[model samples]
Target: MTKHFKSAFRQEVAELVVDKGYSIREAAEAMGVGKSTVDKWARNLRKERNGEETHDTPISEERRRISALEREVQQLKMEKEIFKKGHSSLDVGLNEKFALIEEMKGSYPIKSLCDAFEIHRSSYRYWEESSKKIRPEDLRTDIEVKAAHELSGGSAGSRTIATLVTSGGYDLSRYRASKSMKRQGLVSCQPPKHNYKPANKANITIKNNLNREFSPISPNQVWCGDVTYLWVGDRWRYLATVLDLYSRKIVGFALSNSPDSALTKKALSNAFKARGKPTGLMFHSDQGCHYTSLLFRQLIWKYQIKQSMSRRGNCWDNAPMERFFRSLKTENMPKNGYKNEALANDSVRDYIYRYYNSVRPHSHNLGLSPNEKEGFYWKASNWLARKG
Candidate 1:
């Protein structure tokens, strides 16, 4: 009597010889089939895989071919599902691909998903492990760093951003903030480097009485002033600022089309009035013609304020004012400048009053804003006076 076997069993026997590298005699013995039958099935399957037309394919080989077709259909369905999840193209970021793989790992084989995404299995595994280790707090820090950078008009560096985030009650360190920025691909806009010339002797008769004594015991006791140029429309506009040495605050500022003594006097007048015309104030500024002009001299004497000038061609004598202007231009002012004088005035006003004094973190103030620093000072002073 002849022995009979199922087509599935025959294909299994053939696959043992064709795919599992088993000898034909071994496969036939293992499946209880004849060696000649195993040989015929293996040959037909090989022909199908090699794209050769083969007539008289055994039933076992046909079943193997149908299994291959079904696998291909399943792969197509998986790819369609991936596309529907917004990962249709390989142009997606590696992180995104890794995330998608993780999401579908339970539904599909990781190796198959990796092959479909054209990524190495090892890379997906590494990403999966690294993702598991990321804490939620680190993600929040990244978001805060990005927000602080944007708040500074994309000009603040990691240190500044870290200070801003910390001030917002996060306690983020500069190094950690820097790492977050790097991970998020956030880069700060930097200003051009400035070269200063060697300082010469005091040419004018006015002594350097302030002598770079930037720090004072109280607001209105010492003030520094300087002028910077801003491009407004077709002409350059000058901005003069008066900074209180006690708090790095811009007590008063004036914008003008000319860098004349009138501009400096107006800035001084604004400061004097704003501070309730306080007495015994000393004003320090560079030896610019505007500050040294006779008209500006009379205004200072009228206010009974001692006038001090930086050494000729020396900016350090009035360092606080220079730093304030540098911060203004780099942090908030537009790169190409304002469209008109009115707009320039408004922008400068907003930066000095709304952002610089009230919001920005000043290193001189030990990470406190100008307003915050002054508020603390007054609170302490009032408490001390009451205690006294």
Candidate 2:
């Protein structure tokens, strides 16, 4: 008595060789049978199909029924396998289980799989329908949120992104947007807090006139100046920025290797010239040598600008400028700092003029970018002036 393939295996192999055009060797390898055996099977199948006599064994009714039942069991096992693979974590609760059942819908009846897994078919169907309902709108909002976050250089959190999206005329909440971001695996970068030593007090003369009045009635009425350090190359470099409080936009900025009065003066001069030598501007800064220096004060007087200083060691007096620095360093600064001065300069320029001022949404600016906020103000003002 020689061993032979079961009827199903024999037919399947024969079909592979004769009907499907597979070589006898290929069919034998695939079916785990010898080439000679596959060749014989292929010939017998072809002859049988052609109504010629063949030597295949005639199976009894009991044996046939057993084979059919075995086949049904094997098929069910394979379908069940779809749920078993890649779902071993204990966190796979009802939602995850429902997901598995939905995936097996086409392969097996929903009722059958749910009954086998002890899941309610009604619950799974509800989950399926509910998903379909929100999928379209959710997809649109998800894309918008992701775009806003990326535009902020991965620095915008849920609140910021919600503000940005809503400005485009879509109603969105920070919490809802945050949920969408989480579902899409998007997270904002949060830099660690840093504190720096205060500079030597200002000449006992400069006054703290601005007194934390961070909001101004009009652009250029109150411009705040500040200097911060950046890690460049093997040493620290300084960046001076002058922000127009009304628009919350950085009107002028200068980067230097020295943190001195000259650096702060340069930033002011840039802002002064950029704003067409505006007068009656209240320039506020901390009592650093830069802002309090005799030379810098003279430049402020030349523009007929008033100078205001922050209280000693108190950053809150200049909260707008401090907040801007926080956003810049946390959201835009490179993780390892810049490789050199030139790279640092370009990076800072891009963040200020290209991204921050023009693209990023600001909460205080009613979700508009700094530039957009100013533009809106001027547009409306001009329209009102014309109407008058």
Candidate 3:
């Protein structure tokens, strides 16, 4: 290091340190040398009395890093253009890659720059694809269930409708349908809470003499019957039904204060008048004591009607009739208790005589309502006979 300088260069440096308020460090920053070098030059200037160090400031580390990044970006831009062109000429392979990338971008992250243009991130990385996709809520099942419930007046249980849905060839399981239904809060109306199981039905168990056979060739050939309850105003009102097997039509129906012999009798009486008794006709029902009661047996004998009973707890013995009661409850009964008996009565009446008997399509009867099924068959048979 040198001594003092009273000359121009030293004076200029002194002016910078004094007037510009630059320290030896700041001067080193303004110049291109280390602070020590600048200090050595300043000492020498002070001794020899002249000369400036014309070196520029040192490059910053951050600036160098930014420059390297820019170079990489430019290289990638060129590479992307090349890949895009390469794919432009060859149709299949490149399109497939691009499509794969697009699909993965929406689903998974593009792990690298190569993944953006040339390859799929999914192909490179060991990524897991979750299989638990939630099944969507379908109104079709809802509509089907509601239709069944409406047909039965909300009294039919999930089991019967499950049978219908499965038998109808829909790609669904009744178990699944039942679960979905419960989830959706759809209600089953069959099996009113009260009502005893058929009386000593097992002890007296007759042959499924009915064999669940419900089809009839003529209007008065067969009659099917069942019992269900309705919420009447404040108490329960029970309904007894007699369906003409030939048409599967509601030949007789009676709603009474309770489920008793009188209720069944009224229904039978209405049915008798509705379809004038034909000889050798069959009357089938579950082995309920009401049907076996003296009054019922006497009426059957009086009318020359054949009495048939289903085996105990065996609903399919007279499936068509059992199916009917299921339809009525599901279609009409209010789930929470009927607010008023009169309202329940009105709803049940509308469903049975109006909807189930006439409007809703029954898949078994060639998708025709009972009346339509019978009428069509009669027309066909009559036509065939006339031709013969």
Best by TM-score: 1
Give lDDT tens digits, candidate 1, residues 1-388.
Answer: 9877777776677689889999989988887778898898889777776767656534455555776797899998887777676446768888778878888888888887898788999998888788668689888998999999988878788888999999898999999998898788998876676888859678457889998877798888999899999988988999999999999999998888899999999999999999899999999888899988889999999999998888887887777888888888887778788899888888889888988888888888898899999999999999999999
Per lDDT, the best of the predicted structures is 1
TM-score computed on alpha carbons, candidate 3: 0.51
State in Å the error of residue 148, model 3. Answer: 12
Whole-structure CA lDDT of model 1 = 0.85
Error of 1 at 57 (Å): 36
Once model 3 is optimally superposed onto the true structure by TM-score, how far is the C-alpha of residue 146 displaced, in angstroms? 12
Could you tell me the lDDT of residue 287 within candidate 1? 86
**Candidate number with the higher lDDT (2 or 3):** 2
lDDT of 2 by residue, 1-388 (tens): 7785577877778789877899988888887888988888788777666656655542333445655797789767865675565264325678777777777678777777776566788888788888767677888899899888888888989988898888777888998898799778998886566676654344378888887787787888999989999998888999999999998999999999999988988998898899889877898998788887789988888888988998788887888999899889888888778899889999999999998899787777877888998898889999999999
What is candidate 1's TM-score against the reference?
0.67
Off by over 4 Å in 2: 1-134, 191-203
TM-score of each: 0.67, 0.64, 0.51
* Sort by TM-score, top down from the best: 1, 2, 3
TM-score of 2: 0.64
